[model samples]
Every structure is written in C-alpha cells, then in structure tokens.
Target: MTSFKIPSAPRSIQKDNPIKFLLDSETIDCLAHNIALVHPVFDAQAFKRLALTNIAPLGIMDRSAHIAAALKATLPAKFSEAADILLQTLTPPNVHTDRLGLSVFFYLPHTRFIADYGRDAQHNSGEDPFDVAMRAQYELTRRFTAEFSIRPFLTHDFERTLNQLQQWLNDPDPHVRRLCSEGSRPRLPWGARIPQLIADPSPVLPILEALKNDPSLYVRRSVANHLGDIAKDHSTLAFEVCERWLTDADKDLKWVIRHAVRHPAKQGNATALAIRKAAGGR
Candidate 1:
C-alpha cells in the first residue's frame, strides 16, 4: 500500500496565526439558536454551556470532535431520538443554493455525532443502519454535508454501502448525488482512508460511471476527485476509466476526465498523458 502523506493541518495547528475554528463562539450560538427553534424540548442554555466549556484549547478538528462528544453527552440518550431531533431541525435545500449556510455548517458537528455514536446501534438493529445514516446524511448534505460522516458505513459494510450509494446517483437532490461519489472517495480529505477501495477500486467504478456526466457540476467535481484518489493508488485503473469516459466526451465529462488524470499525468504516465492529449491538453 502506498503511504500517501496526510495533510499537515490535521497533525498540528498553525503557530503564529491560527486557522479559523469552525465551532467558534458565534457559530455555536447560531447552531444553538436554530436547534432551539425547531426542537422545543432542546435545552439551548445547557447545550451551549457544554459545547463551549474548555473549547479554547482545541484546534479546528478537535473542536469538531469536542462538539460531537458534547452532543452525545447532552442530547437524548437513544440514537434514534437524537438523530430525529437533528433531522427535523435541518434547513431545507434550494436549487439556487451553491454553498452551505452558516447554521447548516455549524450543525455538521451534530451529524458527525450521530454517524459516529449511532454506528453500533444502527448496525445491530434489524433495520439497516446505513439506510438510517444515509437518510440523515441526505438531509444534512442539503444544508451542509454528510461526506465525512458517511465514510464510517463504507468502512463497516462496503458492499451494502456502495450499493446504496449507487442508488443515490439517481437521487433528485444534487447533494445526495454528490455524496455518492464524495463519500466513497478512497482518499477523501480529512476522512478515514478506505484501504479496501484503495486496494481494489473496481467497487467504486460503477458509482463513478453513474455520476460521470451528472447535470450538477458539484456532483461532477466530486466524481473527478474520487477518480483522482483512485489514480493515486491504481494508475492503470484510473487511466482506463478516464479513457473510456473520454471517448466522444462532452465538455463537462472532459473536465472530469482531465481532473481525474492530473496526478498520473504529472508522473509522466503514458496512458494518462495520452488521455490528456486526446482531451486537447497542451
């Protein structure tokens, strides 16, 4: 297995000037205020107190982890109960909306909590936990993204998770379609690496094929990234997919193929170079 370098940001916080923390005071306040409005029983004051306690010492990722831990401690004990509250409180997605809203980004911590804490319960239950997580992720991505949260299921049950993701390619929501590719990336940034997919990317090819020419550029970009991740480990496979997609390609797909082959092209791989050449690259 190639030991791909993990980004330095996750290892240590920057020294002189700090990166902005996602779960800062204002973001927490916005999150609490929104949760309070939707879930009447939610204890906003208590939640805020728990969330902000000792938060200054933590960096960006740590803050997100801390917020998830706080939600587990403060929210309803039952996984479904807590997840339901989050699902009900999410802001609806709009077609014109390209970026996540403030409240939605803040609420991502809660979604992470559900995905992590609720994993065992959903797996053990008679019902499919991936489905449960997928539903929560679908709603969550509309506002923010469940891309990070959904990786656990992929690790836990690859076949079932990938199957569901394939179905998601046809979803009405572009976010959900994007999740199909983004969540399944072999080397998703800030996400736990899926060694199985990295070793054998055949599983992910179908999902990418389904999303290759998706109407949404958001989904197309994710598909490109997912392919690029594959190229890191399996250049031959990535080039094959790129070659297939490039035959009589439209403008959008040409962009995806070009992005997918970038890493390999950089390495001077002949097939990758040829694909780039066919795409009219200089």
Candidate 2:
C-alpha cells in the first residue's frame, strides 16, 4: 500500500457499491501514504483511525463525507493551508484518458473535502475561501471530476459560480471544459440539482453553446447532455438552440445536436426527428 495506487478493477463490492472499496482499510492506508508524501503536517495514523471509524454502515457518498470529515479534523484548521496540502497531494491530471473507470474515485474524498469545507470563511480568516475552493476544484476536476463538489459553490453563489464556469469553457483540459457544462447541468445524475438552473436554464445555455463543437468528444458529450437537461424543462429553447447550431453544423456539431434531441426523436416529436434527420444521426 506504500505505492498509493488504486486497483484497476474493484477489489470488492458490497451490494454492488463499486465505490465501497474506496473506504476500505487498504485504500485508507494508501491514501495516507500519498497524502503524507506531500503534506508534512498530515497525521497519517490519526487520519486512518478517523477515516475508518464507523465506515461500514455507509454507502459511497456517505463514505466520502466521512473521509472528508476526517481530513478536516486532522488537517490544518486554516482552510487555505489545508486546501493547498490536498491540492499538492493530487496525482497528475488524467487527460486524454476516457472511461477512466472507478479508480478515479480515489479522489472522491478529496472532492468531498472541498464540498464540506469550501465555504468556511471563519477558517479562512478574511481570505475569500471561494477563490481557493475554485482553485482546488479546478485541479480536482482534471484528475477526478468536481461536478458534485461544485454544487455547494453554485448554491452559495450563483452568479459568481456561473461566471467562473463560463470562463472555464476555453480551458486547455477537456475535463475542465466538460465540467463547465456538466457541473451546471440542471439534473446531472448523482449531482445535487442546481435549483436556479432547474428553474430556468437560460444561464447555462451559453456554456453549452460555447462547447457545442469542442475538439474533445468528452466535452461535447457533456454539452449535449446539459442541452438534454434543458430540453426536459425548456423544450422550446432546447429545440431552438439545436436548430441554430444546425445552420452550418459540421459533423461534430451535428453529433452534439443529435444527442441533445435523442429522447424527443425517439418519441416521434416532429421537430426533434427533423433535427435528427438534419444531423444525420441515423
């Protein structure tokens, strides 16, 4: 476990919770090894003792929350310092590697650490904790998606969050760009729904539009799914957006438009089918 590597395949399962093993004793030991490598102050024994305590009854997210709590309890009380330690502990960003599988969940506790503590101003002692939070998430997304961790930030600051996400559309990493769209998704599965986005998805449309033809399908697919979420609530707007993109759509853009309208097309919605036909998704 000194090597601090995640198994390519899950080591075990409890009721098919593939992520359950992330909280296992071995993983905790390895995580401690990795964290201790970079953070001189991290108390490995204390972290392991706390992380493993009362973990058996929990499911995946609960496990993540539990581990995050342990980190906060053991790491520095100063938010900025603790965030830096965790950020420094990250593995290299996993770019250009699709279907990275469950192993990336190795960072699940890292993301949970931010989500649980990202907005703590008292601990920040006058520093804007949000800025550091955003930085941590940016780094986290490249290695392990920050989509779920970002929701608390969106809830805490809608305009600021959207503005930051908007700015990330042009990021060099496809993972970061994909997060711009995926993180704001109205009904992103497993992610807490952003009520503002769900109530009126207009704010997120610009992000989708910007990434509609992203060079990485990893990013384009997120844009399409975000569009599909918009369609679930704002069908007309989604349809209009798809139609506009189709005006001179290249194959990539066409693929995006087609994916966005797939459900409606399946149900024989005329406009959806027409758009699908134009995109040549058949």
Residue-level lDDT of model 2, residues 1-282, one tens digit each, is 344455354534447555676667876877787788887668999999999999998988899899989988988888889899888777788956475766788788889989888886887776779999999999999998999999988987889988999889899899999999989998999888888888888887788878887899989999999999888888899999999999989999998999999998898889899999999977
TM-score of 1: 0.86
lDDT of 1 by residue, 120-139 (tens): 76433444455566677778
Query: How many clashing residue pairs appear in each of the predictions shown?
Result: 0, 0
Candidate 1, residue 252: lDDT: 86
Tell how far residue 105 is off in model 1, in angstroms: 2.4
Question: What's each prediction's TM-score?
Answer: 0.86, 0.92
What does candidate 2 score in Cα RMSD to the true structure?
2.4
Candidate 1: segments with Cα more than 4 A from true spot = 1-20, 97-104, 122-130
Error of 1 at 83 (Å): 0.8
